[model samples]
Target chain A: MSEFEPKIVAYCCDFCAFAAADLAGAMRLQYPPNVRIIRLPCTGKVDAIHLMKAFEQGADGVFVAGCLEGQCHYLEGNLRARKRVAYAKRLLAEVQIEPERIDMFNLSSAMGGRFAEIVKEMTQRIKEMGPANTDRRQQPVES
Target chain B: MIVADRKPLEEILDSIKDYKKIMLMGCGGCVTICFSGGVKAVELLASQIKIARKKQGKPIEIIECTPERQCEFEFIDAFKKDLESAEAVLSIACGVGVQTMSERHEDTITIPGQNTKFMGYPVEHALWEERCAGCGNCVLEWTGGICPIARCAKKLLNGPCGGSSNGVCEVDKDTDCVWQLIYDRLKKLNKLENLMVVRQPKDWRTSTDAGQRRVKFEEAML
Candidate 1:
């Protein structure tokens, strides 16, 4: 059987995670190409609806990479994002989706190595989980 | 404000499963403030429903509308055309607003998308706590602005119930005994003597126990 290549969406905060991604490129770090990063002003800008919409648009996995705890550029944006990510997981589970498909990560802008590692780790986890059941029979939305 | 919560997605989906075209009516009043029913909520729900239906290969159409206040007839009238075209209406408003929709659009079926919770205020961003009981009586003056009817677990009018221990209600350990709050407030205000006066039982007729209630604005009469 051919190996699964998951479609992962990563929301990277501009001040840290996005910078880390840029650093990874500078350091010649290699990570799976399955991840597509969307840069945001802050992790707090990543709403629960955005995570759900990623799944709705056929993303196999979604992650929010934010600044390290107590080091957010916007004071508590990362903390708020962490809480929202937790909420999104429960919301996904309520709709019968795998909660593990979504996650939140925190790291400093200098952690380029860890940034690459997270991408590879997330890709591996999602690949093991296989493609999301986008084709599964969803509950009828409206009667 | 009247706080409400969205019904479970499964229940909401099930309620309108048979309809191909539906109107999602949002309210801009209390429900909007509570984040349960509003323009954004309507859009989010519509997108969710569309995605769910698409996955199942059972495409459905949703028309969205948000009125200033669903309970007001004037705001609901604005969606007359949309209401006519949709097979059913999913109202994400309080019970009063839902009823208004039904009354306003008697030819169309109106489904409630939220479970009306209580008259409360948001303590913080997303945290809401019940604050009013609408008991048709005003005793805040004697209680030093604290309401025993709503905040009290036992609704004791006289003093703290035996269940109160260390200022917490017995029914729920997390709940503060409202009687204790009232006592403290009265003590602070030097109105502790008010607690000694015996009060008559509340007249239930002033509340829902009198059946459907109405307020007629005499000055606004046509």
Candidate 2:
């Protein structure tokens, strides 16, 4: 059997988490190559529905990296993100998915090492859990 | 608005476990306002169910649709084609909407996805309390705009039952005694006299106890 390579998705906020990822690369901070980073204007823009879609599209693990709780660039965006992430976790748990398969993190824009660390952490966690069941028998959603 | 809550995922999954494909229907009326059934809810639930089925290795297909008001036959009629195509329908509308679809489209099986909770509004961000019992009588005129039938723990009409402690109902510590609220409201409006009226036992016949109720408009009838 081939070794499993988990597919992890990180939703990073533009003002902080995304910048932190950029800095991680600039500073040559090595991280797992399995993560797919998608940047949004603010973590507040992330909704439970978006997280569901990420899993539906075959994500083995997902995390939202945002600004430190009290320091959202848009004031309370990270707080809203926190609530949505929590809600999404509950939804996932209800459906027999590991709630830990999803997570949220807070970091400063300058935390390049931390950004790399989160990616590696997520990759390691998902590897232990193996891949999420992507063998869906669902028909394509009619446009 | 009529507030509702979605049924747990496991029960919903079990009910439609036989179907290979289904239409996930949503209501754009009260359930939408309550954040239980709406376009967004439909999308979220569809993804959840799909993911669950995939994990079980018996995946199902879903088509999502939300009509303006599922209780109205006309709105449900518009989706007849899709309804006929799916093996079954999972409706997230309140009970009324689910019945309307089933009654009008007898050929399709429509399964309810929500429990109709109450006729109420959001007190705060996601908190809703039953406000009106639909008793077919308006007591708000004298009670200072509060209905004891719905808000009261014991549905008391006279005054605060001794069970209340610190203005909160002993039946539920999280809930404020509605009678206390009625008293405060009437006092602020200088209408505390309204509480003093000796009220007779309510006639329960006017409520749903009379059976399935209907309101007809003669002039509007074809």
Candidate 3:
């Protein structure tokens, strides 16, 4: 079997990225099978705690995908999501984790090909960075 | 409301680095409403600390609890049973709550997890701005509900100093001129003369620096 595939958690807005992922499958656009998608009503509902928990739970990489700016079904949800991602980035940096491990993207439901590209790109980036340091599973054995 | 913000995760982790058992106490009153020392914030901090400790191969036990209002003894008393198990207490409350916890639990070390900012109100979701000086005075009726002493950059009482331009203060172009706001509000209420009345100099001793501020109830006391 191939080496352990990096586990990526994708927080997708129910209106956009989630639909795009579904479309990608329908179109048979094959991407790495490392991504685990979590559907959120709006990107804004994805708080810093969720990102941190994803890391703590051993996610090698995480990304939040929301609707394009000013197109959120819940007005300003994407904007708020952007701010939360930025805040979480700062927090991850302070903990010695490369903030780039967590990212945010904006796309429409029709962007199936784009969603596939994102998954491939994030999977490669995480492979280069190695496993997440925040993973509790990798803790050193105590005497 | 007393505004505050959570301490950085690293700093919070460092505080309890030596303690094996820690109680992360949250306040459900002023700091809660501000989103700083609330139950959600306490849980977040606790989870982060646990993860950080586990990553370092250290074993730590964290207990999370929230007092109804840390400033009052009645609320803080609820944590007496939990505090018995922890060596240190992390208070996610305003300065008053931290002090109250410290006073009540002198044997156990207490750490503050929030930096008290001000007495303020929410301007928007997750955004708060200070509004009161707590100067032991109520001048809102005279100033048409705006506190020039706090909101005004210059603290001008009689009128907007000539430094005001286009309804904004000269001290900071972004800040609204308190005198201008007072003028507009008084104009709307048809109390223009209220602005012209000479105001007495405020008594500074009655404010926070004077001594402990107290509210006594005569018949209300049981």
Most accurate candidate by DockQ: 2
Residue by residue across A1-143, what tens digits does model 1's lDDT show? Answer: 65767889999999999999999999999999988999999999988889888887778899999999999989999999999899888777766678999999999899999999999999999989987766432432221
Clash pairs detected, candidate 1: A142-B16, A142-B17, A143-B16, A143-B17, A143-B18, A143-B19
- Model 1 Cα lDDT, one tens digit per residue, B1-222: 999999998898899999999999999999889888988788778767766676666878889999999999999999898777799999999999999999988888999999998998988888999988888878888889888888886677889879999999999998889988888888999988998999888787877898887889999999
lDDT per residue as tens, model 2, B104-166 = 878889999999999998889888878898998778998999889998867788899889788
Which candidate should be chosen as best, given lDDT against the real structure? 2
For model 2, the superposed segments whose C-alpha errors exceed 4 Å read A136-143
Q: In candidate 2 chain A, where is summed lDDT lowest over 10 consecutive residues?
A: A134-143
TM-score of each: 0.90, 0.94, 0.83
State the lDDT of candidate 3 residue by residue for B73-126, as single tens digits: 899998799899999999899889889999988898889988888888998888
- TM-score attained by model 2: 0.94
Docking quality (DockQ) for each candidate: 0.32, 0.73, 0.38
lDDT minimum window of 10 residues, candidate 2 chain B: B76-85
The residue-by-residue lDDT of candidate 2 on A55-75, one tens digit each, is: 988888999999998898799
Q: Please report how far candidate 1 places residue B103 from its true position, in Å.
A: 1.1
TM-score, prediction 1: 0.90
